[model samples]
Every structure is written in C-alpha cells, then in structure tokens.
Target: MSKTISFVLNGRQRSVQVDDPEMPLLYALRNDLGLHGPRFGCGLAQCGACTVHVEGKAVRSCTFPVAQAAGAKLLTLEGLGTPERPHALQKAFIEEQAVQCGYCI
Candidate 1:
C-alpha cells in the first residue's frame, strides 16, 4: 500500500508516498526527495555520516525508516546551515579546518 506521509524536512513541509514501511529515510531523502547532504556509510547504522536531527536529536538516517520519520521534524545538514548563513558548527569546522577528505560535514 502506498501511503502518503507528511513531515517537516529542512524546515519545510514535505510528504512522500511510500509503499514499504521498512524503507530507510536516508534513501527516501536522497533518492525520492533529493536531499543529499547525508552520505551513506555502513547502512547498519555504525557510521555517523548519516547523522540528522530528528526532533532536535541526532539520529542515524541510514537505519531510520521513513515511516518512523512521519510527522516528525527532520533537520539534515542542509537545514542546519546555508551558503549565505552557516551554522556555528559549520563555521567552527571552517575555522578549525577540521574536515579531512569527504567527511560529510
């Protein structure tokens, strides 16, 4: 059954029709919705690369099912900062030069 689930993504109200309840939110965000900030690293939820804020708490998007994200506010890397105005963490990362290779900051 293709069910439509609505949620707040990057501070924007968005919805997606999904058939499987076990489909991870990461795939839905990247493939379906086109939000690609979070990278895929260890789909088993071992890596922190797929970190995203779900209702003010960091969560592993790789394992987070889209069904669970329904009606919840999701803040990915895109939402935390922007090109014009970056977040404090982003600014700190730039200042400290903390990124090494594709760190998915």
Candidate 2:
C-alpha cells in the first residue's frame, strides 16, 4: 500500500508517496525527488557516501527507511552549499583540494 510522507528537505517542506515503508531513504532522495548530491555507495551502509543530515545529525541514508524520515529535516550536500555561494565545508574542500576522484565534491 502506498503512503504519503511529508518532510523537510534542504529547509523546504516537501512530500511524496511511497509504496514500501522499508524502502531506503536514499532512493527517495535521489530517485524520487532527483536530488543527486548524496550518492549511492555500499547498500550495507559501510561507506559514508550517503551521509545526510537528518534533524541536524548525520545519518546513513542507505540504511534509513523512508518512512522513518517522515516529518524530519534532511540536509544533503545540496542543502549544505551551492555553486554560486558555497558553505564552509564546500569552501574548505575546494580550497584544500581535498577532493579525490570528485566523489565527495
């Protein structure tokens, strides 16, 4: 059965309908809404590739169910910074040239 879920994404309130409550939050962020900043790495949540801030705390999106994220605030890389005016993390990463293979960038 499909259920409608609402939450805050990048400080913006948004909602979507999902058929499965156990579906990973990463899929909802990337596939459903077309937010590509948080990438998919190990589905087992071993890697930190899908790290996103949920209610001001970092969470592994791959392991977090979409239903569990309802009504919570989510902050992905897109929310942390932008191309025109970047955030401190983005600025630091670029200034220090800390990017490897452009994966984290």
Candidate 3:
C-alpha cells in the first residue's frame, strides 16, 4: 500500500514509498530517507528536536503528516551545512559553546 510521495528535500527532488500517508514526516525522513537530523524528541510535538524547515519556515516534523508535505520543500540540519562548511548557526553554536544533549551538534 506504499504510495509514491514526492517532495523537495534539502534542495533536491525526492520521493518515498509511504504506506501510511498519515505517518509523521519525521519517521519518513529518519527511517525511510535515512535523515537523522530531525530526532523524535516528543511524539506530541511539544519538544523542538524534530524541527525542520517546510517552505523555509520551521515546523515540527513529528506531528506533520507525510502527505501534507507533498510538493513542499524541506530543510533539515543536514541541509544547513556540512563539516567542511558549517552554517552560520553552527558557527554561532560553536562560538558560544552551547550544549543541549548534542542533538544537532
């Protein structure tokens, strides 16, 4: 019952076979697409660990339905930058030495 769900991920066109369209986008990104940037902090979407950019706005991927992301653009921590070229935020975190469970570090 997996249906093809296509969307733009990290500035690239991507698709996945999602049997449950209602499945959280977090699971699809992590389990199916192998993106560990967004973590399942709280299933209730209370925590901010599973935060991602949808259409350039930060949204909780844990409670976001996979089907709802169709045709949308997504950006995870992985998309922000790489070790050789970390994003500005990553550089700020490094400069301030902020520590929070090392989720995005």
Segments in model 3 whose C-alpha atoms lie over 4 Å from true places: 102-105
Clashing pairs in 3: none
User: Using alpha carbons, what is the TM-score of model 1?
Assistant: 0.91
For each candidate in turn, the TM-score is 0.91, 0.91, 0.91
| Ranking of candidates on lDDT, top first | 3, 2, 1
- Alpha-carbon local distance difference test for all models: 0.88, 0.89, 0.91
lDDT of 2 at 38: 84
Q: What clash count goes with each model?
A: 0, 0, 0
- Candidate 2 TM-score to native: 0.91
Instruction: Give the Å shift of residue 42 in candidate 3.
Output: 1.3
Cα lDDT of model 2 by residue, 9-56, tens digit: 998998988999889999999889999888888888888889999999
The sequence of per-residue lDDT tens digits that candidate 1 reaches over residues 27-100 is: 88998888778889888888788888899999998998889988999999889888799999999999998966
The sequence of per-residue lDDT tens digits that candidate 3 reaches over residues 1-105 is 779899999989999998899999999999989998899887888888999999999999999999989999999998999899999999999999987786443
RMSD of each: 1.6, 1.7, 1.8
Assess candidate 3 and give its lDDT. Answer: 0.91
